[model samples]
Target: MLQMPDFLTLGHVTRDLHSDGSFSLGGTVTFAALTAYHLGLAAAIVSRADQQLIPELSRYLPNIELQIQPSPQSTTFANQYREGFRTQYLHARAESLEISDVPVQWREAPIVLLGPLAQELSPDIVSLFPRRPGTILAATPQGWLRRWDADGRVWPTPWMEAERILPQIDVLILSHDDLLPFADGNRRDADAILHRWSMHVPLLVATDGRHGATLFRHGQTQRFPAYPIDEVDPTGAGDVFAAAFLTHLHKHGDPEQAIDFANCTASFSVEQPGIAGIPTTEKVLQRMNEKKNLTT
Candidate 1:
């Protein structure tokens, strides 16, 4: 019998290339799966990677079960950061993921995170699991905002299915950067965008890096402050936040507590690089305890 995982993420595992030709394992699945594992959840990933990259994947992905769809080349990206700004380019893309890719047994995962990094997952994939009590469905729609030029220079594209899809998601995680195109770089414009999107999504978040994140639910908006800490690489912090929030929400079923735990978990992720940044449950609880002590 196939074992069902507690947390399951759907996306492509990426090969991130640097200017010097060095590559690292990346993508939402890579980071989120590790975050879930560190949180002590039985996690699994459904994604595609090139056959040649399996060994590299095995290095970072020891305990996680990977449901890989075969592809000639993995989804590859190059991100160049200068003065706090990043310019991203897509070098290659893996095959699009379909609902058929996921196993029947894994459909019952308590926390389902749909994190498509390159528009690889089909929208219809949402139908796979209907709304069921105790089962949460979350999505990070970064891929829907992406459109690459001929040279693979990635730019934000419009998402057409907000009305149809957002209603299906229990938790929708997005950053200010992810919605910038819709907001036209204006902070005031972002409010309108968030308000529009929140009409369909019951729980929606718009993160603003170190400052904090804004949560919208049931027509009420609340701000969740981020923990201030010295930062290193912010690469997977958002994915880490998404995983932490979903895992905590699954276990605790309290959005306020979950966001607080997630913000605390993500604070640690920005302190290190890559998967090394993901905090263990012990570390997160330690931070939470510290906060409680400070408040008391």
Candidate 2:
């Protein structure tokens, strides 16, 4: 194996099958890793990208540290929807990461983001680093609950392992709908359920469509309004937002700046399709600068 890069991303890789003529590549791992690279971070990705997709995945992927694993079968996803509503289905097995696969050089790194696509990604992955240094950002429960039927329709399953995973996450991000599985689809009851979910995670965020999102940290609630935009295809917007948010937090160490940057980045993402919507860090900065100028 080549020397593993010090910066790493643990997440999923899925073939995003859409209704349009476009069969694009997607996943938290792809968007986040790429966003980090755009922001000048040394980045690496560990995911299941079989022989076939690896060639394609390599092209869009910059020359950086990459770890590819063979799967029983490559993981595939069909994201089907009409208008703004959407549903997904899984068609194949995604790979899993053993503790042994984590690079020794990364043992001391201060930042790691845990992102997953399907059920194959386990909370047990966190156990791989008991003494590992720094923060661990987890896009969980949302990732943990994903399951696909034999016919490729994605649905929710019990994330029995979430208890183990929650305690391991420093920052957790999920959509308001992602809480449905745990809340039994009860929107009104999600608040109580989320409170329990946040006990283990120091910072927790839940985004609710155009209604905006909630941030819970240090026993206080802060809400940020979602920038209104005509969403074209919101495929990877959340992942991109999380990537931008994390980049800001890591680079500037300020909560408000991170949220503002993240909101702008995410709003920018929804204005286009797939990964094409992910803007560069400079674009994000420029947009923020514009917003600040108008407000002032």
Task: Choose the strongest candidate by lDDT.
Answer: 1
lDDT of 2 by residue, 3-104 (tens): 544346776677776677456778888877777777667778887767877777778786656777766656777766679667777767667766666667
Taking the tens digit of each residue's C-alpha lDDT, what string does model 1 give over 1-296? 76999999999999899789988889988889999999999999999878898666767798998888789999999987899788899999999998889999999889899999999988899999777899999999999879999999999988887778998879899887787777778887877788888989889887889978888886578998999899998888999999999999989889989999999999999998888889899999999999889989
Give every collision pair in model 1. Answer: none
Give the lDDT of residue 38 in candidate 2: 70
Candidate with top TM-score is 1
Looking at candidate 1, what is the lDDT of residue 167?
A: 89
Tally clashing residue pairs in candidate 2.
3
Q: Worst ten-residue run, lDDT, model 1?
A: 51-60
